[model samples]
Target: MILKIFSNNYIINITKSLPRGVYRILPSEEFKKDDIVVFEIPEETKKYLFDRKYVPSIVTSMMKKVASEKIDDVIEINNNNELIINSKNWGKVYKYDSYGRKLPEIDVKKMKVQKGEIFLLSDYSDRSFDGRYFGVVPISSIKYKVELFFRF
Candidate 1:
């Protein structure tokens, strides 16, 4: 995340953040709109994972896009349980994993992000674990922002 040694190299991203591609990975903490950001798994999310989830081979970090960072941006879970942010539909809320298994629950009907946190979404992959499942994440969790250098 904050490692300079990981820079200046073509990092092939197979995660859900963006279409699988070769990207210029940067060690950064700044939040830029539409930027592909990387963050360590949220501590609040540990409750739902296995006991050894922190092991490097397991799920260490994840990459996702900020669905909406604008102040007072409204996030809503519709009657159908779809996630709509800032009046735009993001998709069905995180109810199932990529494998179709049922999962951790969220009960928010409407919310306005005043500060301290931001919502994230899978850039391309459906069922990608993100804010839709774990809910709004603190801004402090962001560790890096990546840029697409090439796409396959």
Candidate 2:
């Protein structure tokens, strides 16, 4: 579905089958482990996602549009300082060296997802730039929990 925010509209393709029960909860409600939600992506994360292509190397690649508002499937929530996300498409991850230049983090295998962080994953999991690349998100960023209903 294409949702417009501010002036930009974001297109999120919902493909999951709705479970047996469908309900909505108050914002004060606690989040479950596998809840699918819609949340506001921070400006920093939006910029990070936007500038991903031009970071370390300026490759003239065709850039796809990413939005600050996301409909994500929650993976792990705040427990320590980590959130393990499973976004569909992985992007170029940049980490600063001692010199402060943009460089790829080189170690996706050893990278650890921490607690107290709100990491999000794309349901597609094959073409998303999710929490793994952007690191953990804050718990306060989540907006609502939603359920999908497919009528076929």
Candidate 3:
């Protein structure tokens, strides 16, 4: 099924991690904010996911779009589920947990991105396994940047 779902670097996502569509991934020397990139899961998170059975053992990669406004930016979330970067409205995120349970409105997080790290969020749907589950990933982890032309 994966063979039929992809060709070369092209991959079709059945999940709404990035708008629930196909994306063209390719090797790149660099990527900018808002560019979706294919990358490896951070080892710490991967282990936690495996130990907790949050993610299957077969999961090896992840697709996360860079959302940090820039290096050394601070990210904040309000009760309204808004992703505020550097005091400016950048985007929104899911307010509910995956199990349809109500989560704390006032997210106790004011994350500041550092050098060689990025802030990613799955803002398309409330059920994405991202949000509080994922945080500041290292830049060196990225493998390919997705082409924005494929409904990215």
Candidate 4:
């Protein structure tokens, strides 16, 4: 499924915000928070949602900075190899395996932002399939940030 957009990269000067409608991906790397981005909707979400292959979303949360190796809080590594985050924030700590690796089940808070993931939200949440259900999206997946919308 391909997202259609103008092939030429150009910017238009306009004042009023365009009405809510379908937008094509105008791939760029200068997107900021709250910007509406277009990405290939994950296959998992497509099973029960929109029929389109690509979708638009608003960036609700953006990673401030890349995480470094620092222990801000302790976190437990569950049996599934998934990090269980009980609190809102995930601290900076590195996870590794030692000789005869033992999966530590410790209580801690905070989890670092891995892969610089961004949280997305749908413009029309009530009827839209978006980040609320898709979870955080990596910056690499964002194809474009919508600047204008059009309807036919």
Best by lDDT: 1
Residue-level lDDT of model 2, residues 1-152, one tens digit each, is 21323233222332231222323322444555456655556666556645654232321111112211233433432334233345333232334433565543323344443444454554333334455455445556665555433222
Question: Candidate 2: misplaced stretches above 4 Å?
Answer: 1-28, 52-116
Better of 1 and 4 by TM-score: 1
lDDT of 4 at 37: 58
Evaluation by lDDT, superior candidate among 1 and 3 = 1
**Candidate 2, position 72, lDDT:** 48
Evaluation by TM-score, superior candidate among 2 and 4: 2
Per-residue lDDT of candidate 4, residues 48-130 (tens digit): 33333222342222111111212332234455443333332222222332233322222322333345555444322222223
Poorest 10 consecutive residues of model 2 by lDDT?
A: 59-68
Error of 1 at 59 (Å): 3.2
Ranking under lDDT, best-scoring first? 1, 3, 2, 4
lDDT of each: 0.67, 0.40, 0.63, 0.38
lDDT of 3 by residue, 36-72 (tens): 7777888877786577665677776777667773656
Cα lDDT of candidate 2 equals 0.40
C-alpha RMSD for every candidate? 3.7, 11.5, 4.0, 13.3
Q: 46-73 in candidate 1: lDDT tens per residue?
A: 5465442323346556778878776767
Candidate 4 local distance difference test against the native: 0.38
